[model samples]
Target: MPRADRFLSIRRDPLSDEVLARGGDPEAHSLLQRTGFVPVARAHETYHRVPTNLAERDEARLATEAVGRLRSAGYHVDCEGDFDTDHRPVHYLPLGASVAHIAERIREATTTDEVADALTDLTAAHDGVLAAVDEVLVALADFHEGLGDTADPHIARRLRYLAEERLGVITSDLSHTRNALADRHAPHPGRSTCTEQVPSNERERSAVCACPPPPRTLPAPPPPPVAAAMRR
Candidate 1:
């Protein structure tokens, strides 16, 4: 397994007697060896827009609960869906972003200072959530951007970097992202072949990038009105 630098390693099985002594499983022990687990709560696989049937009620409740927990923990979760793909009818992004919730806060805020306070709260929630759990950074990035339009320079730069530069959210379908990257950047001045694909948990994995970090995320704003509302 790669070194556990930033993220903690989840072990299915205990490796040492001391671990087993502490009630860690010894048999069937295996580490989640993906040294690079992406912040994947918002992955297309785990989400559903709104569970509709009674059988799904618990899952729906859990989903909302998860969102609440993530918000409390400091992740900036956002909802996204595509017309295609039943798997991702809706999912949360728990990362840095620049739209929707933040924008709405800006609009609803009574004063310019209020906007600043609101953004601070939103970002605090984001960073706090990511302190232990990094999986929700994707959608959370944009929650305060007002349902999708934000003025955060961080979000703006990331969006510009991806939409225009063609980075992140790369395709997993037959490795199209790799191919496209290779075609565009492989021959660039002093750049290597585009062989390194951005993993799904794209941001944290970039800490070791040979180049500067790609704009998968920017810092988030805050959430003061939210705190005030809660205090009431």
Candidate 2:
């Protein structure tokens, strides 16, 4: 069975231009640089604490806005959380189907032919996800370019950086998947005495000698915090 590669977790933040320009809030600006900026409604209470109910509603609205932003940017919205202990809502948007699902298909394959087919399917799935990420980068670039001189330089820089980072991850994942498949399909140096030599093609190889082992499950990482708001 083929193990799943670790998925990238993206944190989104919604920040206002005013907050970015504020003198004492480097944290907000730093978050914007790291996660890219989304538009969020202004908080009414600058000094005083906001009421609990109002805070929760605001967070919920932010999460919904984030989901929409991601979709518009060309990502598949898997699911989202309501609110955390900090009263912040974080959304989980996977690029495609879970790696676990692909792993399950690999594990269930009982013959060499089946395993080979599963590997092909997994490779194709990975390619599709990489393509989706590329589409998102193109869309973001188009949007940024459309803004021309009116675009905020800081926001434009952060968006470009985020897009590059995503492309790097997707490209790396594709390389890793390709290497793993190659290792799996490579011919062994020595022949086993107990069994006849299997065919060169992976599909025709002997099941006992060529079938992949059960994939090891990696522990899922902690959810990323909500960095900012996505404005509607």
Candidate 3:
């Protein structure tokens, strides 16, 4: 079956006259934002909207660009006629995917040192992911400092607070955890570590190693059947 994230739609809400986008995954959301849409999160779902007061023509262009970009990346977009396009812009790997790769590495790691090594990409003090985020927060704060909006200064302060308080706590905790894991020299209990050294006492001389065969993966059982009364 096709994944839910592979489809999205863009259209102007008839009553509100607001250009809105719905039914896409995080990657599609990123494409919408890059093409000048603001995300609005609700309890049930999240969607994107064109900024208020944007000229009608500009809104169409923005939505059309997002449609083209999403289609280019192989997502199916159901959009208004005005936003339909044959254009498919080239897509590149997003930077966030690199950070997500670290999580994948940790998931596949069998030893404490391997997990710690993967975390170093996030916890490194000089050029790590958290450090880059801190730099971004500070840069955003600086941008807000000169903006003439009544709330810009307050926004700047809030950004600084987040960088210093929230992100700082996360960075400190991860750094401590990384250092601890680096020192542990322990293998994960649930995972096997293959040293690739055949046992000296092995009766079979052609044995490659002493490691046990990988466990078999079993399929999940089907859900219980609904009673006729419940169906009625």
Candidate 4:
């Protein structure tokens, strides 16, 4: 990741007189948001602002907390004097991180069963990640049903379609893949399991493993350097 992504500033916008958080990547943005800032997306850039109508003191408090949280997460935040502090707040790993862990497991998997085990976390019938997401979407749709806004019904319908149609497709596909892999009982041909054993003919008496080094994942050789059009 870029070093710039770990730096941000929290200050009041002169024109709007609103406390705004500028710079930082998506994770940093999420941290600011959870600290009570609303996101403002524009054609050129995106930033976060303390909710409007809040008292000036409340806005400063929110900004201070955001600075502490960002610092705790290893981010550099430049803020106004009132918002700067040495206190770093404690934050727990978010629920999304657990789902991301499944992807990490799949990346390191070398056998069909290993991949299947990770997929089970997402596709399990009883309380898997996708199932919990479906439940949340349904609940949100229900909440919007009686929200009394002119657009509430439409919003609810859209949420239902996403929960049922879009998410359903992913759940179905991953479930099928998981089931097939569960039955395959095969290891990846291109990868090998490390036996952690020294060969009998080993020249090094301290050798702990005899497995060949894993191949480096080189990027596709830059698009065969595009040749310039021959002189006409």
Candidate 5:
């Protein structure tokens, strides 16, 4: 899908007023630039720790579709979200993936202890992220601070990607669901909503749906970018 159609954001982060006053696009190292790292971190934690727990309907679908290994290696089947009837969501951790990454990082690090430390830290950080988002967003703040400019670029990028995708799915779902709710039910009278209003008689309101919104059909998940990148 074209980047334009896939995401609604004008840009992930736009230049701030202060930066704009200074000059054109801010420099790469500029602290003034806005980034979704905070929420993204939480999202990453959520996915790595509990893949099935992704809140947005579209995200879960996309993640399942993106699992290239699951497809190529055989035993690949995606049951389109019939969880309400068929099965419950469950998270499957890609331990092999993590171990492979850790090994590669260990090769790059200076010492065996450093390698061990890095591996431990990465796993802990990953778990910390998951726990924070699902169980406690506030607690994740501390986990965020512990990270610095030194982690592998790929890991950071992946986490950020997961976070943004999740945000999109969630934001879209909520907007859609809210519109449906408002069209059918009044909120505090005169409350504004983009959802369309439906007609119903006052006496028949209990029997009839006033302000009935159209059925919500979530957009299909965009195809995974690449096989390697899409792997859990």
Candidate 6:
């Protein structure tokens, strides 16, 4: 038989065969069964070919696994079938970091400097999410334009609604957080600590008393709104 044919002909041994091979060792047989191990042909067959349909299915399974990982790491992804020339679906994931944790950190901040640092970090994270949103939107718009009437009219409409309604609300919340922080840190005029008085030891002599200004207390910033839907 040709090498490929021989490979294709090779099959796994039956469970009964496995049990008979380990006849005296019931524990070992049980172990094998428990592990679901299937005995395969020992002959090396390098030309074995998998059916194209099976290969495509495995590719799709792997892509789905990859997208799951990306989402776990805080990304926004959209995947659909027939995205590539080879008919393999492509993922349209965007790069964005979660800001929910940042909000919690800001809430836990004890000092003004800590709060300021948290605000800065939150700003950066928000910007990153916004940039990712913009990229996805632009890409979708271009795709829609390219397809014109050939594209499903509802597809673009739904995407636009998500981008505007969902993402817009997130951006607005971020702006509110920024404004609250800015207001908390804004400086205000206060009474001075310097005073002048006549010296008791020398009636004609005048002395200036310079007292250190009391520490200014900053009002606590309003809690940042939680973005449960925008976890990624």
Highest TM-score scorer: 3
Q: Could you give candidate 6's per-residue lDDT for residues 1-232 as a string of tens digits?
A: 2222111111112552111111112222222232232333235522112123345455444444433443343333344442112322233332222555666766666544455556665445546546567568867965776575855566777777777788778767875676576557532223222445544665545435434446999999999999788565
Measured by TM-score, how close is model 5 to the native structure? 0.19
- Stronger candidate by lDDT (2 vs 6): 6
TM-score on alpha carbons, each prediction? 0.16, 0.30, 0.83, 0.81, 0.19, 0.34
Query: Residue 170 deviation, candidate 6, in Å?
Result: 2.1
Candidate 5 at 130: error in angstroms?
14
Q: Show the colliding residue pairs in model 4.
A: none
Model 1 ranges off by over 4 Å:
1-99, 125-232
Question: Per-residue lDDT tens digits of candidate 4, residues 39-79?
Answer: 99999999999998999899999999999999999999999
lDDT of 1 by residue, 112-186 (tens): 344445444333333522221323333444453455555565774554455333422321221343234434422
Model 4 poorest 10 in a row by lDDT? 218-227
Residue 210 CA displacement from its true place in model 2, Å: 17
Candidate 2 matches the true fold with a TM-score of: 0.30
A best-first ranking of the candidates according to their TM-score comes to 3, 4, 6, 2, 5, 1
Q: Number of clashes in every candidate structure?
A: 49, 8, 0, 0, 3, 0
* Root-mean-square deviation per candidate: 26.3, 18.8, 5.3, 7.0, 26.1, 22.8
User: What are the lDDT scores of the predictions, listed in order?
Assistant: 0.34, 0.44, 0.94, 0.93, 0.36, 0.45
Model 3 per-residue lDDT at 83: 97
- Tens-digit lDDT track of model 3 for 180-217: 99999998988776789888899998988888777999
lDDT: worst 10-residue window of model 2: 16-25
